[model samples]
Target: MVTERLPAKISEKSEEKKIAPASPIGIFDSGVGGLTVLAEIMRQLPNEDVIYIADSARVPYGGRPPEEIIKINQELIPYLIDQGVKLIIMACGTSSSIAYPVLKDKYKVHIIGLIEPGVRAALSATRSGTIGVIATAGTIHSQAYQKTLQSMKKTGLPAGREIKIAAEACPLFVPLIEGGFIETEETRKVAKEYLKPLLKEEIDTLILGCTHYPHLVKVLNALTGGKVVLVDPAEEAVAEAKGLLQKAGTMKGKTFPPRYEYLVTGSVAQFQDVGSRLLGKLITHARQARLPTPERSDGGQVHLPLK
Candidate 1:
């Protein structure tokens, strides 16, 4: 419940006025991985406009230090707020695990992370007491999923039934997925090796801990022989967002087609190329975003370019 204060400019803008339901919902990740979350949002809340940011320039947040990850989010959140988004989703597993706790109540806007929803779904899907989580190294190292499962299982599962959690960090997943190697045999072989340990534990439920892992559903489903239930946090997160919007009366009306804007800190063409395939749709509106540089030597505030 700790809240970190935002910069004066951002705080004033975000808190000074009521956010409209028609404003876009913001979603972001280090790279194309967040498209999985975007896909779910589009499917479940088709009436809400979406603005998605891909910080591909700083791709693979999994390996970054906690301080660096927090700093990166500080930049990304303000930028999204500047765009007048009503809510924000931290769609990256590394960010959800490492940065979300630090920044959760800090911003005026409602920020939803992927961890809790995925954990809830995994807990519900497990027929046995065994569950597996596969995510990036940073997420696994954070112990976010494992801890949540343990804490929730105490009340959520049958009494006296021991819960076993197995976690594996698949570091190579983001690169392979971002490179558009979803259904290749090479990717399949790598996935099998990565999943071997969890399968050894005989886990009946597997959480797709990283957003990018959802893109490899076919490979993972094939490897697990359709026995292990794969939980995609994106679906649950979107469902949660939809419920919150409805309860708050902030759900957008069905007056027009929802607008979709794509922004990336890296190459626009590359993101469009890989992202289009992953989302199973053509991306005709992607553009590069020039984020503000880190704090200046004199401690002056940096400003983003006007949209």
Candidate 2:
């Protein structure tokens, strides 16, 4: 169930307020793709409130310049923090690859990106020490997953066995998924061409590197014929979040129904329609939100409005 309401005014002296256990977990993405992550979070951490921000106005961050991605995140991250979220999840592969490393340490709230979790999961699932990753061009260009896998391969797998990694950039997947073309023959055709190289490499494990790629699981599975293990990084990322919250003693109590707030920087009607279809539940309402202007104050902080 979803409902629309005005956001409460957040105090300017936000730093003074402690992020309590009951504070909402914030998740943001380039667009509706992040709903994949949100689904895992809901299944695993049902009692916690969630504030999801979809930067659909700038959807498809895949091919953007690195500087532009960072700038866009500079606006979105602080806006989420201002909403009083206790933690933030970088649910977009492009952002996770390009912006996360640059911005993670600068923020006060804990930020979890999809790369590390994905690399770890792929390593765990690869019995043959051969893995393939498919994501957006920006993510592939950044070489985030490839580098991480290379670095961790020695320790993650048996000593003598080497890890073979094949990475591909499937830029069309996002547009197809966002356009609500999940199971179409065109999607299957595109996916088949994309997976051909990885299949030729005989990879035993495949990482659905983009959050948007999970929606194409049916096509993916059919293409692989149940021979390859598929890893959805959202599962590991949410599990890591659960572990961190538990260790920090900040898991929300099961005393009440969890609140789910949806905000977008684009069309509410479109987001609701596609999001509902992807999530298999009606997104009855989603409030439209704007990012704080890029101008920074003397202390180098983005000035967010109280409302």
Candidate 3:
């Protein structure tokens, strides 16, 4: 059996060296989309603290330029780091694509993105050679999924085989989810139209490349007729985070599920309303936060408003 080596510069660490038990695992997305990843991480790594930030003020980074996305990420990420987070999870697919290479090597803590894990899950689940990916406009336009799939094909994994990758941008997905329309007929119609190509292509597996898409899981499932497998990238991302934390010995003994902290850059009430719909649970409060200005080249900073 061949063993895959951990990426260079990442290694085992002693858990006792940590300064505080309350250190959080910082997660950020363009808006409430990240809650999907937060849900999975809370489920899988029950003992850690999660600090989730929703940049609702600048929601839907899709269709924006990569440089703009990078600026947003640079600002959001550094703020999370300043909050003393042990690890940073880039839950936004667009930001992950634009900033991961530039930011990952610079951060002292571990950085995990949604793309590679999503690709891995898609590759693993596909019995047929073709895979379908549905994401935001920015993510699809970035071609991150295609690039990852191509890299996976080149890497020669065990039982190596080439896989065909297809991607589509579902621009309406986030709006539908945030508008509390996931269960509505309108959402179903959109899902059907957006998914038609993949269905026609006879793709056996589909990657739900956008974090917000998971909130519409049932709608998508219904449209796909339970035949095509849908892969939630956030779920796979959390699994990867658990593995990394475990291997690094950062996992504390399981006592109880981690407490979740939600922060939003825009309306708190909207976050609660939309977050409750996405999370399938009521969110009483979302602490206010100020994201950095994109103009700042130093990766703008974030400030939490006094409660």
Candidate 4:
């Protein structure tokens, strides 16, 4: 699961001291939902440049087939690579669950996903040895959380104790959050319904599996009575990335603050609007970029046209 921060094939000249290793870290999400992850990375790694691409044109990957999401990422990733990103963050839960392994093995650059960090944090936060995961339908269907917890339990849990993992798919949460209904009472009602199962389980820790789920933290927290701890993967993921980059000697934070660049497949205005809401501040220039289309003639390969 470990990936190099940069490709060895990258010109040694590019690795020289004349250029800092602080190139942009690329992040991709199915849609505006990923801005939450992007914001976390910005807050945690202020010295590193960031590039976020929102695939709003095909927003919800949650219900898409794994192969389809893989196809989407195969096209999306190389564009980011060409942007000179030092690392790639699969901010979308669907992509992380299904596509990350293939991309991580194929790409020489470091690739991090959102799911594992959340799972790890949930495991750590749970004193009752029971963890609840709430995610998009696709993520839940993928059984990523279930599989992860099972593997960890087999290897890491004490011989007598079992780690119980409960997962629910809150499909409505994504649309509600992305549609700017985060603060509505409707959202509260929906959150209560969706979270009641976990509340009954009395699980001590909950993982906000979808990047969009964090947007409803207030509603979710109220439903849990502030007792159950909520784990935001974005936070954990950035922390992991910080440690990884530092250990790799690839971070440059002793000088100026890191710059950030944002790219989106949808209109710049739309991304800016949602991004600002997610970041809780103004989002500066975000250049518009189109996602590549698949060319069947090329064996389901993505063909990028001139930007």
Candidate 3, TM-score vs. the true structure? 0.85
Better of 1 and 3 by TM-score: 1
- Candidate 3 minimal-lDDT segment of 10 residues: 1-10
lDDT of each: 0.85, 0.86, 0.76, 0.75
Estimate TM-scores for all models: 0.90, 0.90, 0.85, 0.86
Q: What lDDT, from 0 to 1, does candidate 2 have? A: 0.86
- What are the root-mean-square deviations of the candidates from the true structure over C-alphas? 6.2, 5.6, 8.7, 6.4
In model 4, the runs with Cα more than 4 Å from the true position are 1-20, 154-159, 293-307
For model 2, state the Cα shift of residue 99 in Å.
Answer: 0.9
Instruction: Determine which window of 10 residues in candidate 2 has minimal summed lDDT.
Output: 3-12
lDDT of 3 by residue, 1-307 (tens): 1221112122223122342445779999878888888888767877898888888766777866777677667666666666678788898888777778777877567899888988888887888768999998888888888888888855524466668777889998887777678789888888889988888888988988888888887888888789888888888788888887777766756566577777777677888897887787788856876543322322333322221
The residue-by-residue lDDT of candidate 2 on 90-164, one tens digit each, is 999999999999999987789999999999898888999999999999999999999999998887788888888
The predicted structure with the larger lDDT, 3 or 4, is 3
Q: Write the per-residue lDDT of candidate 4 for residues 196-292, one digit (tens) a residue.
A: 8887887888988888888888888888889999988989888888887888777767477766666665557867887788778787687766443
Per candidate, the number of residue pairs that clash is 0, 0, 0, 1
**Model 3: colliding residue pairs:** none
TM accuracy, model 4: 0.86
Task: State the lDDT of candidate 1 residue by residue for 77-102, as single tens digits.
Answer: 88788788889999999999999999
Winning model by lDDT: 2
